[model samples]
Target: MSRVRIAAEIAGAAVLLVAAIGIGAFLREQRTEPQSPAAAPLAESLAAPTQRPQPNCAVLGQVTPVPVPPLATVDLANGKKSITSAEGGYTVIVPTAWLVQPGIIEGTAWFGQTRITSYDPKTLPRPGPEAPGILPPSFGISLDLQLWWNPKGEALDQFAQHMLIGPDQLAVLPGGVVSVGGKQAYRTTIQDQRQYQPATGPVITTRQTRIVWIVPTDRNDRVLVAYATPGESDLFPEVEKIVGAIVLTTPASPTLPVIHQRDEILGRWLYDKSGAPIAGRRAEAKLLTYGETVAAFGGGTGLPRIDRDPDELFWLVAVTGPDLPQGRGGPGGTSPPTAWIMYEAPATNDRYEGAGTRFASAGTWPADFDALPDRCR
Candidate 1:
């Protein structure tokens, strides 16, 4: 063969060999790559159904069954009261002379009555949508009733800021502090009449109201009682009389403090109120001091890692399946293939009520460091 022709043939052979090796490598790669597990069934089980089961409309409507609790009657005229039996999980207290109205208040989510004594429950609607009934009258002594019926601890701060402070009707005044019934309270006056617009439009209005933020001395609770009247001038005198007359007997909480550290929480523990583990069955924990900003993991789950901010009133940490990378598992070990969670630490004492201290909202750190989950006595 001529030299040029031989060289051309050799080059052609080299090209074919390269192409063959490339194809072989591609095939090997395809075989070696791992296949992700089929996440459909897992996802379906983990995800809440978009549609809820509808009741059988064809069936005739049945009368609603009511659970009866023991009712106690009080004769205000003679100042006589009797408790037959405490049946409901919650205890209801009324003044001797107050008239109790039975039934749900209009535009309320639940059924309850307004008890009118010297004070009118009808006048006091719940501070937020979650609560219903008449708000307390303007006695000048107001309570910032922080509501968190089923909220995570980390979200309590944000809930307070957005709901109470955002109203513009109430403003946190500078250096407003007082003592109510021996409880150190922070008082702030409402500068203007604020209106909250519900889905149906403005359902409630307030004017010249004062909010007293009472932080407990040693608990994770804060109470915001708002006192307002039609007029705007200083209502401190009436507030003093009303506040002085308030008899607050601390109710027993299901969750008691197992460990109290100065501004740092560690380990896994169960929450007292809900009897659920503070460390969700699938949670992890790290020691965070007061004022350190911790990033929340997972997505959409408003779980907050307590950060160190002097203004932060509450700090709690919790985790769940969605907070983990593997997603939340179900009873049968099923979980979503993908999940997201986040943790937040709020700077306001309004996160937890009924157990907050006067210094709680002041951002005071705990002094000792003891993580005792077993001590949940």
Candidate 2:
């Protein structure tokens, strides 16, 4: 985690990232294609909507209605640079002075400096494609946008409830249902400690509040838009304006038909324990993505009966744990899946409509479940 500091006096935030693409392709291929005009109406109706009424999402206990600005708000005039995450499936604009670093999780990360004036150069390495490297004249706040891999395979609202802390801290998902970036999203803010260094200076530690927006990309996938500030509330307004400029693409994939990258389960966490959220904990459970060829139910048969719904209605199933045993998936192998961790058995999803409820059949999940399995609740 790298902190933000652009000049001698000003402080900034931290750098964040996440895993990359593959499930994106799997998700696209599973869609139902429209064969008739009736289905076309349904598909066309779901066009990249800029606004929609609040949904019945109560999993987080309540809905904090937040208005989303138009995607058109993001443009060359408002940005120095723009970053898109194949893993997260979205794009965000940041200040022109911010340094962009490649992060496996955050896709691309940045030095959290809001503005750059002058800096003291030191000996520290700048963050790059392979590391959370820190640069000179900086330290303190952090910002990241990652697609949170849901371990419990629950709806976003439900997951928010389980992960919620009181308020003004990490897991501040009181607003599980928010609309931003031209898409429906989940909002949370976390204040935590992190360390960063100047070019030639010793490592420094600081506390900052990170506001996160968990936006669902597709079935079993979500992207987190996070901005950390030097103080609790100093940068909220500024960060809000930055995030408000986001515009989510429909289907949320950078590429279509075929995704060249594999959506590997870069890592898994045992969403167990309590207290401070546990990170980098060994995963005790495994997630399996199961999708079926939903046959169209009508009088016609054969070719005429198949349906086409670009939207994929899929869910993850908790499978044998400790290893990527499903198919040819391996530990860090190219074949592993990066999706949900079916937290509870016999869970149901309504995305399939008449497809009926999905049953996990049987499995054990942490819950006594929490993201911070390493720390005690």
Candidate 3:
């Protein structure tokens, strides 16, 4: 593989990271709506019950009453209670041992252990050489309810089908369709592994199970609820109960917007052979762009890699666009994407030039296109 191809792949990963923030913002703006006020009964019924349950007790609520109580004002160590955030549009009954906080931005909300108040994923300071791990380690188990706006008219199942799974990083378990809030959803289980290096200890491999719920929001976004637990633990049933009880106050729209920015660069591109018969050299590629980055899929020797061997191979590249000048408000100039090739690969162009040209066009994609991909169907 050529170094250019390797660099393109790395660029793709960086693009995905930056694009994620953009996607989050899009979801927030397009899909989110103010939730209806909590029902009156939801508040009165959620008050602490007269009888106290065991410390390990878990409570799930079917409805969120109005006049929502303030869990933050009361001490959680005393006993378990059902709480609802009228502003957030969902309710959860947490044990006295767990702490719950209302989401301040968009539809974000949190429920879990107390140590979280000081730790913020966005603002947390980086660990130096002496402390290379999260200063205060996170609890082995965590749960979060996230809402995303989906401007694309993609169903929950369709979204699942397009999910890019990195073969080397994650193992996805067989998942099937499930229902949430009376709407169809896709539920899947994923085994994720992370490598962390601490200053005082050798590298550590941590494994965890993530339960994912992707439900179409009926508008521009979808609601994604996730529950993560230690790989060896069985918290599915408990988590499911919590997920099953969620009710949305916002109504779903029947139609989606006619246009989306992603459609412009999402398609197939090719470099036709100059002069040849049926055996003429030809190259084809597919690209998907979201937010500020793009993901490339297809096989061809036209890609670049620093090292290569005799083995046949395919490639997936995630990359960002060329940076513009700082004053122009864009990523400043950066090296262009490169291509690589290997003999006997499933897909290959007659020459690297053809592939390189195709990739370059994709790297600096525009907002309009004269042709789209058949594969998009």
Task: Provide backbone clash counts, one per model.
Answer: 60, 36, 28
lDDT of 2 by residue, 310-364 (tens): 1232222232222111222345434333222322110122222212111121233
Candidate 1 achieves a global lDDT of: 0.30
Worst 10 residues of 3 by lDDT: 341-350
Q: Against the true structure, what is every candidate's RMSD?
A: 25.5, 20.1, 23.3
Q: Per-residue CA lDDT of candidate 1, range 1-377, in tens?
A: 11111121123223333434543343234223422345333323333321222222121112232333423455545553322212211223333543433211212111111212333434543354421212333422222122112223322233234333222344544435566556655554434444556787555664444443332322242232323232232544543555444344432222112132322232222122344432222222222322222211211112111101212222333322222233223554554343212233322222221111111111112222124121111
Lowest summed lDDT window (length 10), candidate 1: 353-362
True-vs-predicted CA distance for residue 171, candidate 2, Å: 6.3
lDDT, each prediction: 0.30, 0.33, 0.33
Best model number under TM-score:
3
lDDT for position 120 in model 3:
33
Question: Candidates 1 and 2: which is better by lDDT?
Answer: 2
Q: Regarding TM-score, does 1 or 3 come out ahead?
A: 3
